[model samples]
Target: MLAGAARPRMPASAARSRLVEPLSGETRLMLRAAQLYYRLNLTQDQVGERLGVSRFKVGRLLDRALRESAVRIEIVHPAARLVELEDELTDRFGLGGAVVVDVASTGSEQDDELLARERVAGAAAVHLASLQPTGAIGVSWGRTMLEVAAHLRPGWTAATEIVQLNGATSQSARPTRAHEIVERFGATSGAAIRLMAAPAIVGTPGLRDALEQDPSVGETLAAARAAQTAVFSMGVLGPESVHVASGYLGATDLAALGEAGAVGDILGRFVTRAGGIALPSLDRRTIGLPLEELRAKTLTVGVVAGAGRGPIALAALRVGCVRVLVTDEATASWVLDHA
Candidate 1:
């Protein structure tokens, strides 16, 4: 059945439908399919019959329509998730994709942070799992990454390899949980793990050079560079940051980094608001893949939560270190508003 010469009448089920945007060709067909399946309350078979195609083809077209924005579904409810925020973040930041998790305050600041972290991590884990990633995946170690690992289901990937993107040896007695983060990701995926057994920052550039020269460290760094996909978290510059808590940096160092316009750290390397190295001296002692290398990766998913994390997240997006972002609603809104 062709969409013929006669002006098509809006079906009874389409009373609430409206054409808000212009489309043509395949997009027009997509919109038609969407209208038939959604507004007209037609099943895939019915829609396909009207459109003169197989039901399987209709399914693919409907999926493509949603992906291409031929149709937009808005959920209206008291607790409706703000799906638009994800689109806005991707558009505003030029991101490849975004996942925004709905998070409500839990009354206590501590509980709220914990809940938000879990929500954001769960979203990231699901997104990663959906990708069906294989081969070497570069990852960073931190609280956020740990949460992400915890949320990942078994066999998230097949025959994958996990490479630590940066040195994780903490200067303090408190555990960085760095190894645990990589190991957990590897264990779930049945992957081969390559750990960077060294401090994130050494006392001097020469010491950093000597450590990188080691075969084990060099091999891991090489794998990190070659991996096309990476997942990590942005670290806000603050007293509560993992670097400070793990003793990789101290109060005086944080003060220096702040004075240098550092907004956050990516892969343990602090960067400015404009995504430039915040401090050359500090970065020289840092052991990890350079910030510029991140831009070349096929996928770099940055998972960050908490209101205070907005600046770093924005910096990561602007710098092109992160292609996809998984974060809570408040943080996403904050990034969009501030960006």
Candidate 2:
């Protein structure tokens, strides 16, 4: 080998002895920036100062790290028992779907109201949206139904119609009590709404006969008869129940109902323990669709909750009043275990 020329290049290991072992300043700064930016949660300027580089360089390094897929983020939801409860309800009731919300035992009044309203509305929206392009959809009124109306979707175009199964009175708070619900259905599906303007309860059986003769109310009642699907809630007897809460029944009226072996009600008509509609005196005056007419529909969904309502729900199921039911977990469990 020549003296000036390298001695035929020592082995590769010998070459390493002449090379630098430490990383370059730029390489070290890039790694330091990555750690500070992601792990330490420092600003670009702060990371740059620690690495003795400009903030611009630190920003570039972060961008590179992200682009190279060096960082990954993930999120997971905590497991809950509500899912199991939902499944149990669907299977037991033979329902197409179900949702059970977690309500605090000592939750505030406002919270409870919000929870009830939200659940009812959510269920209504889903069911209404899934209606066939051409069919009748019947609705009944109560606090829960009112809340459901409040949350109904604003616009729809599914080719349907809204028929009021029950009457709303002139003495009532509003002639359009169920107007929001019908309007929502109409808006979303472009369906016509048939309005029933007769009083839910008239002065007398004679008065009811006179009102039913009105063309407008008669037409709405006819539409209700042809309904293919209906949505309603079970009513409980007494002053604290929804009927009383909605001011449809006064204190004395409720007392009278209790004396008649009325345990619950549906669409303002009282029901017996066996779920048969009672109140021979008031039946003729009641303007809602008949129980048999409702049964004729292809789908009848009844949404109800509360532990005290289990018996009525069971009775409704027994009498073939409700083929599809949407209820809370506690109520659903009680119905399956007890009813």
TM-score of each: 0.77, 0.66
Name the best candidate (by lDDT).
Answer: 1
Q: Tens digits of per-residue lDDT for model 2 on 1-339?
A: 347765575578866865866666665667778889889999999998988889998999888767765655543343255566567656765655555554545467666655754575576556555544357778887666776666666553354788878876545443436666666666666678876787676657887777776787888888888887787877678666755554566777667667777778777677777677667676676777878788777877787766566667766666676766766656666677765
Whole-model alpha-carbon lDDT for candidate 1 = 0.88
For each candidate, what is the lDDT? 0.88, 0.69
TM-score, cand. 1: 0.77
Task: Give the Cα error of residue 69 in candidate 2, in Å.
Answer: 43
- Per-residue lDDT of candidate 1, residues 1-339 (tens digit): 666678778677565445534345777777788999999899999999999989998999999988877778777764455578889988887888899989888899998999999999999999999987778999998888999999999988874799999998875878788899899999999999999989998889999998898987999999999998999998889988888888889778899999999999999899888878899999999998888887799889999998688888888888888889999998888888888
**By summed lDDT, which 10 consecutive residues of candidate 2 come out lowest?**
71-80
